[model samples]
Target: MSAKRGIELEPDLLDQRIKTLAELGDLTGDLVATASRLAERLPRLGTAPPAVHLALRLREAAGSSGLAGEVEATEREVREYKQMLSEAKRKYEEHESQAREDLRAAEESAATAGPDATGRPGSPRRSS
Candidate 1:
């Protein structure tokens, strides 16, 4: 018979499904935080030397002079952070997919476990 027809469920198995979902949520949150960190590390163009030199040369040819600032190491930091963030995101997605699958399996197991032994909704409880 189907679970909706009053078959018993394994409460621990259902709890495991909920735990998997919670883990997926945590992974998603981490991915978002990594993205934000990558964004913050991104280098700005106008403040770097190479870009400033190019702009200065262009302005000089056009008979205009402007001050250019020194380069910051933020570009390197940004590159490193971007790569780390990309890898982290990939791992998070993979784990999330696996966790979702595990949750589904747990739900299916709960649905087909057996008739409720407690006259309630769950399987027979075992001593801890």
Candidate 2:
């Protein structure tokens, strides 16, 4: 396939990937928020059973901080990937536009050149 056609067909994959990445980022953000809320409310449950407090302590020890860090890193990666996708799409469109213009100009040149300009073996050259 031609470069222009290839470019036209290529964006679907990137678009789908970008969409999936965005969804993942959103889900990760929600998870982080939910975890933070759970940690906050766990201690404020007001005179819970001793076993419950022990469970809360165990849960805290498992480290929401690490999960937060991972969420942050993943969010940053998602932003970077989105930016890269946007730049790639912009560049592809620029290339496609230039290719189209080049094709149009070539067609015009060929048409204006008339019969003899094709440079065939038996074609006659135009008078200077």
Candidate 3:
């Protein structure tokens, strides 16, 4: 099932998204640490076969291609996405700077060239 959601999508929002991704990465890092310690954190279940089997299963669930692994993978993906977004932001800033420069140059050029048929820079031509 899907529900419609309203969100503002703008260039300025990239920074917020990047920060959110970083925060998500941090959370996943914490999860990985906790999951890695799951075996040690688990209580002593005694020497019975059933207990041993349960302990082993729990350990596998915590470590083997499980919570820890999934968290680590998610962290890596988040970091990668953050890097990509940072690169895109840098490129966008560069292009924006260039565009501003270009606009300033055009304005300066226009100011120098002036208006009307006369060569005067700021003065307008008077009717005869």
TM-score, one value per model: 0.35, 0.63, 0.70
lDDT of 2 by residue, 29-119 (tens): 7877766666565455446698688767845743466555566677778878877887887788798899999999987897798867666
Residues 1-128, candidate 1: write the lDDT tens digits: 58668554444565555556556545555554544444344244486789777655554433312111111123334445555655555666687789999999877776676444324656576577
Evaluate all candidate structures by whole-model CA lDDT and list the values in order: 0.52, 0.72, 0.81
Candidate 3: worst 10 consecutive residues by lDDT? Answer: 1-10
- Number of the top TM-score candidate: 3
| Better TM-score candidate (1, 2) | 2
Q: Which candidate is the best by lDDT?
A: 3
Error of 3 at 38 (Å): 0.6
Candidate 3's residue-wise lDDT over 7-124, tens digit each? 4336778999999999998998888888888845555698998998888888888884888888889889999999999898888889878999999997788777667634657767
Candidate 3 Cα misplacement greater than 4 A, ranges: 1-11, 40-43, 116-128
